[model samples]
Target: MAISSTLRSMGLIGRCFVHPIFDYLVIGGGLSLIVIPAVYLLADPPVMRDFTMLPWFILCSNSAHFAASTVRLYTKPGSRDALPFLTMVFPTVTLGVLTLCMFEADVIGRYVQLIYLSWSPYHYAAQAYGLAVMYCVRSGCELTQNQKRFLWWIAILPFFKVLLVATSKHVVAWHIPEQLVWSQVDWRGGVNLVTEVLGVLAMALPLVLFAQVWLTNRRSMPLISLLVIMTNGVWFVVFPLIDGFVWTTIFHGIQYLAIVMIFHVRDRVARPENKRGVVFHTICFYGMCLVLGYALFNCLPYGYQMLGFGAAESVLLVIAAINIHHFIVDGYIWKLGRGDANRRVVETVAIGTGA
Candidate 1:
C-alpha cells in the first residue's frame, strides 16, 4: 500500500511538472541552494576554508545534466547517440571524480587550493570535448586535410588554456599568504588576463559552431545547447570583469532565471501534446524563484559584508524574473510560430521534394 501510494504521488508530480525545463530548474536550483550555503557554512572563519560542498554541488549539477543527456540520447530518436554519450556523459563522470577527489578529506589535504584552480581548465576541457563531438557528428561533407588540421588545433586549445592557468599561479606566489595582496589590482592583472582569454575562447567556440549550424541546417537547435553557450559566455565575460567568487555567488543566485527561461522556451517549442496526463512544466520557474530568491535575499551578502544581502538579492531577483518571463515568451513565439512536428515533417519533405 505504501509503495503504491508513493508511486501514485510520483505519477502526479510527473504529470504536473516533469518537463525538461522543470527538470533542469529544480535540479540546478536545489544543488545551488544546498551547495552555496554549505560552502559558506563549512569555510573556517580564520584559516583554511572548506570548499567540499562546492564540489559536491558541482557533482550533483553535472550528474543531473548527464542524466538529461542520457535521456536525450535514448529518447530523441534521431539524435546523434555517440556525441552526447562521449561528450556529456563522459565529462559528467570526470567531473564527478574530480569533485570526489576535491572533497575527500585525504585527497583535500594534498590538493589544497589546487582543486579550485583546476576547475576553470577542467570545464574548458569538458566544453572542448563536447564541441569536438558536435563537430564530428555534424561533419556532413568529407573533411579536407586543412579542415582536419584546423580540427586538431581546435582540440588542443583547451589544453593550452589549462597550461596558461597553471602558469598564472606563479604570478603572485610571493603574496600568496596575503589576501589583500593577491586581491590587489596590480598583482591580479596577469591572472585576470589568462582567465579572460580562456573564458573568451570557451565562449566563442560554441557561438561559432552554432552559427555554422544555423547557416547550414536553418533548423532550431535545442534550447539547452543555447543555454549552455549563453551561460558559459556570460560567465566568461561577466565573472572576469567583476573578478571574484562573489560573482560566482551572484551568478548562481540568479542563474535559475536562465534555467526558467530555457524551460519556458523548451515547453513552448516541444509542446508535447499528451495533455491528458499530468504535466510538470515550470517546476524550475516557480521553485527557483522561491528558493533562489530566499537565498539571495535572506542568506547571501549577509551582515556587514561588502555587498549587502538584501540589496544584491533584490536586484538579482528582479533581473532574473524579468529574464525568465522574456525567455518564456520569446520561446513561445520561436517554437509555436514554427508550428508543430507534423508541420515540420511536411516542410522537410516538401523541401526534399523541391530539391
Candidate 2:
C-alpha cells in the first residue's frame, strides 16, 4: 500500500514493467543513460569495430534487441491474421532486398547502408514520441490534435541536426561531387549554428511541453513519460558527443529489450491456457532472440562471405536489411489504435512482482 502511494505520488502511469523501478530505469532509459556511460568512461574499454567479436554481448544486447521485435511479432497469437502482409509477405520482401544488396554490394548495398543510417535517428525519435505519448494516453491525458502536433515536432526536432551532419563534405563525398558539397557553398557556419540551435530545442522543448501540461491539467504528466523524453534527448545529443554510435545504440537496445520483454511476457501469462510463469516466459523469449540474433548477425554473414562476398560488405548489407526490417516490423506490431491487441497490453496498469 505504501509502495502504491509512492508510485501515485510520482505520477506513475501505464507501465511496461511490474514495478516503477524497472520501468523507469530500463524502459524510461533515464537512469541507465547516466550510469552506463559513467561506468564505460571509468572502465575505458577497448574499441570494438565489430560487435560480433564479443559473442556474448551480441547474443545479449545487440542481436537480442533486433531479434526481439521479430520474435514478438511472429510468436504473438493471431498476429498473422491481424497483420497478414507484415507477418507473411514482409519477410519475402526483406529477403529479396537482402539478395539484391549482396549481388550489388558496391551499388545497392551502399545506398541501403545510407538508408539505414539516415533512417535510424528518425526511427529512434519516432519510438521516443510513441512511448512518451503512450504513457500520457494511458494516464488519461487526452491530448488535443494541436497538442499532438506540438509533441511530434518536439520529438523529431533532433533529426534535423543529424540530417545536417550527414550532408557535410566528409560523408557527402560518397554520393555527390566534392565541389557541390554542403560545406563548399560556405554554409558550414550556418549549418553548424542551425544544428546547435536544434540540439538546444530538442532538449528544452520537452521541458516546456511538460510544464504546459502541468499548467493545463493542474497535475503533472507521468514522471516516466517526462523521463522518456529527456532520455531520448540525452541519448541522441549528449551520448553521441561522448562515444558516437556505440552508446546510443546500446542504450536504445536496452530500452527496446526491456519494453519488448514486458509485452511478450504479459501477453503469454494473460492467456487462459498458458501455465508458464513470468520468469520462464522471459527466459524463453530472450533465448529465442539470442539464437535468432546469432544466426542473423553471424551465420548469415558467414554464408554470404563463403559465396564470394567480401566479409565486411556482407556483414554491412545483412545489418542494413535487418535494421530496416525491424523498423517496419515494429511499425506494425506496436499499434495502439482501437481493436489492436497491443492497445490492451500497453494501456493496462500492470503492477506485479514477476517480470
Each prediction's TM-score versus the true structure: 0.32, 0.88
**Model 2, span 90-185: residue lDDT tens:** 999998878777887887766787778877878788888888888776666556787778888888876666777556312564668645774457
- Alpha-carbon runs more than 4 Å astray in model 1: 1-20, 23-116, 119-198, 217-220, 240-355
| Among all candidates shown, the one with the greatest TM-score | 2
Candidate 1 on 1-355: residue-level lDDT in tens? 5754443233221211235454334422333345444654886432213555654443233223323322323333233432455434653554354334333434342232433344433343334333333222222222345444443444445445444444433234323534565455465577668767866765566566545544444332333343433343443344332232333334443443333344343444465563431134344333434554444333432421333324433343333322222222222222212443222422332232211
* Model 1 lDDT, residue 239, Cα: 34
Candidate 2, residue 85: lDDT:
92
lDDT of each: 0.38, 0.76
In candidate 1, list every pair of residues with a backbone clash.
15-278, 15-279, 16-279, 16-280, 17-279, 17-280, 18-280
Error of 2 at 242 (Å): 8.0
10 residues in a row with least lDDT, candidate 2? 346-355
